[model samples]
Target: MDDALVVGGTRFIGRHLVAELLAHEYDVTLFNRGNHDNPFAEDGRVDHVEGDRTDDDALEAAARTVDPDAVFDCVAYHPADVRAATRVFEDCEAYVYVSSGAAYGREDIPKREDETPLASCTAEQATNDSRDSYGNRKAEGDRVVFAAADDGVNAMAVRPPIVYGPHDYTERFAFWVDRVRRFDRIVVPGDGTNVWHRVYVEDVASALRVVAERGEPGEAYNVGDRRIVTLERMIERLADTLETDVEVVYAGSRELAAGGIELEDYPLYRDHPHIVSTAKLAELGWESTPLSTAIDRTVAEHLESGRDGRGQGPCRDDENRVLAALDYADR
Candidate 1:
């Protein structure tokens, strides 16, 4: 794609995607609310349009002005948003939506591009509620995009699971990095056997480009590691990568709840592993980023950014509360 437009390109995967686009010699245009510090605002190489993606009028105007060959959407949530955005991108040769793996009906079995059932979504489920998880809503959005294939939008979806790497705002990986550091002892809920699936932010960005350039329209591809990585195994990898000496403490759920804490308090603690297959993406000639590489680079970035690699966990206080309870029990 010689010219392309990205919706919401300021942070995380979007930021990395923009960099990938530039690397491929594609002139890029970014459309967002201009509410945050843009890493690309200074680049003379890109066309910037500051507007709301849901705002039909503004998007249509920008679409006419930029006239890109392919459009990548990173923040589209609801079908309503997709409908509005596609109306603006009607003429683009390719429309790539960045969706999440949560949309799958089942994560236990290895899922393909089309074999898996999509989580049900209703228009009423549009409002944010725990009943309508993001996975189901993304399925709704995916349906909307593929439905537009009839209108010749050349649409496709790239679903990624738990994307982590540099510039991650969620602090998921940072939680591990910090836990490896400054904690003489680390705690994990349960036996730490939960399934973990994730992709590097930059690799996801690259896969998006491959999707935009070569993916079959009206289809979705899973972009992540084919080999499943368990929570405990990854933690062991983290300790090895950071060269940290810490004892791992496994706590039961009963005690955690009694202490006003849950597995959520312990970062990356999950009851089930999110097993996903990237076989489809691999078929498209997209290579998955090694977990070891992703971990090293992420830690290096966190350290280079002047972060002390200490106490970055979101549930630090809650974790301490739970840990204190465990310590009391030991007494």
Candidate 2:
């Protein structure tokens, strides 16, 4: 497809996706509410369609204007959004929706695309805009894509787990990057073996483009790092990237409770490992960025952006209390 229309192209994944599409020589137009600043505003290659995606009229107008060969929906949080988008661009060569790995209902060592059961969404959950219902709603959106495909719409879905890298506003990963860059000794929740699969933002953008060109309709693909790492290894890798040495202090429930903190209070801490299988995406000529390389870029951009990730997790004062308690208990 030579022409593409991206809905929600100004932030995080969507921003990188626009770049990817342009790199592959696709004429790209961004359709958004104009709430956030457009990074590509000055670029002559990218065009902007100012409108809210929730308004079907505005969306239809964009479809009529672009008549793009492909459509990518990055801000579809609810099933209704996906359903409407697929309908509006049903004739496009491909319509890809950005889904989440959380859509899987069951916990497995590595969640696969076809085998894993998806979370259930109710009428109320579908309409309610809450983080608690995010997975359910995303799963329902995948179903909507499937139905659209069955009706001859070239709709596909890509599920990514815990995406991180440059321009990550979530600051979830930044919390650890900051911890390693700023401190000699940092508290790590659990025994440091906690596993939460993460994919780099650029890889996600490439996956969207690949799925648009090569993926089959009515199908969903998982995108994540080909190799997984534990929480301890992740921090160690970060320290390596920053050329620093620090002690990784493990804090359990008891140790954290000394500071009135719970393991769950820490960001990226999961009792059970959350992993997704990427063999499917790999088959479509998709690969992930190396952990070390991805880390280097993430840390560098983080330093430049000056995002401390303070609001993303527990405060340092609280962590210091936990550390002091650990020190006392050790003595």
Candidate 3:
């Protein structure tokens, strides 16, 4: 698409998507509430449309002003938002909604686009603005895309597992980056094989563009790292990226209890592995960033931003207690 509209372009994935669009030489416009600082405010290449996606009138105004060939809905948290945007931008060449892998109702080794069941959203859950209902809401949003596409709207969805990379406000991966950078030895809960699939922000940005350009209407594609890494290996990757050596200690749930820690306390730790098949997205000529390259960019940005991913994981004091317990048990 020669012209693109990115809703909520100032934050993590949206921010990266704008850069990706600009790099590809597409005229870009951002639609957001203007709360977050616009990274492109100084750049003369991008345009901004100040409006709330929640307000139907404001969104309509933006669609008219931009008359974009492609529309990327980054702030669509609820199904209703997707419904409204599809109706407003039905004439666009493509309307892409950013969905999440969490939308998969069941935990599977590798969740696929069409085979895996999507989480069912109750009407109440769809409207509730809570993390507990996030997956359900996102699933409903995907459903909205399907319905819109059925009505001739060129709408598609891309579901990414956990997105990580530079400008990640969630700071989930940054938590581990900080530990690897500052500590010689760090404790990883469980046997350290927990796999929570994560896509780099830049790759996710590219996936959005690919979906918009080449995806079929009514289709939802899963986006993630082509090669998945375990929790332990992820830390190792981070350490390698930082050019540092680290001792990755594995702790069992029972041992972690010595420090009042649970496996859930770890940001990226999961009891069951979570992986999504990206072969579907790749079929459209999309490729993920290499692990080492992704980690290098993430670590470089983490060091520059000084984001320790604080509040995203258990406290260091508690982690130390767990380490002590593990050491005592070893002895």
Candidate 4:
């Protein structure tokens, strides 16, 4: 059996990729901290090993034991982490790094895999309070993995944008879905004209699988859907889906920043506004599901899981006030 090892297998995208790999008949071994309960216990094909990606000794031991054909890294944040993991998996057939579209500099030019210049921080020491440091660190991480590709090991990078779906702990999408359902006045940022690119979690996983099987070694692929939606239209769609009459107001990024309203700091990267083209993935024969369907599924799943109070009691009026406040600030 062809074996693969996945780091961060319990995450939103990682979990879906694990399922997809199992469906494709690849004997998969999961390497994670095992902090959460096993979500795939019913699937006997998955083997679990507890370890940290940054710990070279643990990774080397796991690599020697699993002897995987490929290593899919879903949690590499720093270049050092990638370097540490690659040192251990040098003999693997392929090493897949889950990168982000934000690695591309916010230049005026349209970004492609090969055209955009990667950015990195050069500080001698690391500080946790810096925003500029994070993306640069991720860019450096990408370089580390790309350099690790050699005669015995192949490396590929997959960059995705704003992934959302069931089991999504990011809660960014849920924040919006919950607000829209309450029939409150919505607030949009910066004229509500910024184009946002999004990809469903399942689609992202499928694209990752496709790239793993066919992506060019030492190459990066953009795995976003072609369609870009504005924040205003997204709110409208949500209101329509929920059959709620909600008013929308406009606000400036500067105003929100001044008011200490930090909607932009959300973990899901929902604050960034940019148009990303996925023509390359399309050329690779990957098809994305409709955006409406994705939204409906996510909202339905959030409701069904009883996570957002589907059956506790009559939906509280206090919920409406909280949603309205977010809506006001988001605008």
All candidates: TM-score:
0.91, 0.99, 0.98, 0.84
Clashes of each: 1, 0, 0, 2
Clash pairs, model 2 backbone: none
lDDT of 3 by residue, 71-112 (tens): 999999999999999999999999999999999998877888
lDDT of 2 by residue, 205-269 (tens): 99999999999999999999888999999999999999999899999999988788889888788
Give candidate 1's root-mean-square deviation (CA, Å): 2.4
> Lowest-scoring 10 consecutive residues by lDDT in candidate 2?
258-267
Q: How much is 232 displaced in model 3, in angstroms?
A: 0.4
Report each candidate's C-alpha RMSD, comma-separated, in the order given.
2.4, 0.7, 0.9, 4.9
Q: In what order do the candidates fall by TM-score, top score first?
A: 2, 3, 1, 4
Better model by TM-score, 1 or 3? 3
Q: What is the Å distance of residue 171 in model 1 from its true position? A: 1.0
Q: What is the C-alpha lDDT of each candidate?
A: 0.81, 0.94, 0.93, 0.73
**Alpha-carbon runs more than 4 Å astray in model 4:** 123-131, 150-152, 253-272, 306-331
Kindly give the stretch of ten consecutive residues in candidate 4 with the minimal lDDT sum. 309-318
lDDT, residue 243, model 3: 86
Regions of model 2 farther than 4 Å from truth: none
- Tens-place lDDT per residue, model 1, 97-209, is 98888888876566666788888886677656563478888888888888888778889899998888888877777777777776877777787777767788888999999
lDDT ranking from best candidate downward: 2, 3, 1, 4
In candidate 3, where is summed lDDT lowest over 10 consecutive residues? 321-330
